[model samples]
Target: MAYDIPPDLAGMNLLEIAEQVQARKLPPVDTWKPESTSDSRMRIAADGTWYHDGSPVTRPAMVRAFASLLWRDPADGQHYLVTPHYRQTIEVEDAAFIATDMRDDDGALAFRLNTDELVIAGPDNPLRAEGDPDAPSIYLAVRHGCEAKLDRSTWMQLAEFALERGGDDLAVTSQGETFSLRPSA
Candidate 1:
């Protein structure tokens, strides 16, 4: 069988891509069962760039399409873009998407992802600080066991917001509750 690869999405802007993707309901990817195989060349870099055959996949539509097909296998602890017939392993250096923007929605923080998906930081959707203290990176649960890494600017904004709370350690508040972005000094 053959697969029709999506065309170049070089011209469509982010909003157009978001609209296109959001309008469609994702297929039931969780139910797909296929023989898992490692795909050495396809990867999702830490910066949220997708690559195939060792080249950057710059097409927005293609990325969105592939992202929709992503499924996390509990047995192997890896991510795959699954179909009824095939499951291809993808190297994800970090979280699949980046939180590009943040909004303080009435004391609750809302994160906007690179894919234009909005995730509200709360009890259910939580944020975690990872990596070294000198260079910490923030991650938030975006959806379906997938996390979105916060870009440097967004993390800085979150840190600043945390500082405004007047604490010895880094912390941010959402929905009248507080979450520590960094450990207490």
Candidate 2:
């Protein structure tokens, strides 16, 4: 079946389209459902093209699809994915120093560490199943009212904080590897 394009996304970049998709600025048909289970599932074609259930996705529709997936929150409601190993408490915003090292619902080794550093992995990256024994593990830190910084210590501290809180609602997952963090309350 053919899908109609959203008027607003007639001309926009992938990022802009993604934003619009998240905002619900376009119709639902315009977005791509990456997690769809059937052959009729919509997807972005290999050539950077968009498709819905096996047909070409219109430019506007493709933009909306990319936008929705990119901007949509994976977290339960309050959490955001900084990376595979790092997630910050949304309620805390900036003051909360939080992180975690636990298996998600789908059973992937997940890590959440807060730091001012932008680096997420190092020579001995913890996220890796097995790598350099002496490699360093970098952390991604989010500072209050400031951009996130990269440092090893900061990530460790964030993880420690989240561990102390001890609650299940804070962590959730949609697909096997796609994990998200939410506040306990």
Best by TM-score: 1
Tens digits of per-residue lDDT, candidate 1, 42-77, equal 888999999999899988888988888887667766
Q: State each model's CA lDDT, in order.
A: 0.74, 0.30
What are the models' TM-scores?
A: 0.76, 0.19
TM accuracy, model 2: 0.19
Model 2: per-residue lDDT, tens digit, 1-185?
A: 22222343223434453343246442232133334222224443323344445676567544433322222233443322132333322222221222332222222222322321111222222221112323323222222111222234433443444355566532222223222232212
Q: Which residue pairs clash within candidate 1?
A: none
lDDT over C-alpha atoms for residue 134 of model 2: 37
- Determine which window of 10 residues in candidate 2 has minimal summed lDDT: 115-124
* Candidates in order: C-alpha RMSD to true structure: 9.3, 19.4
Q: Which candidate is the best by lDDT?
A: 1
| Model 1 weakest lDDT span, ten residues long | 1-10
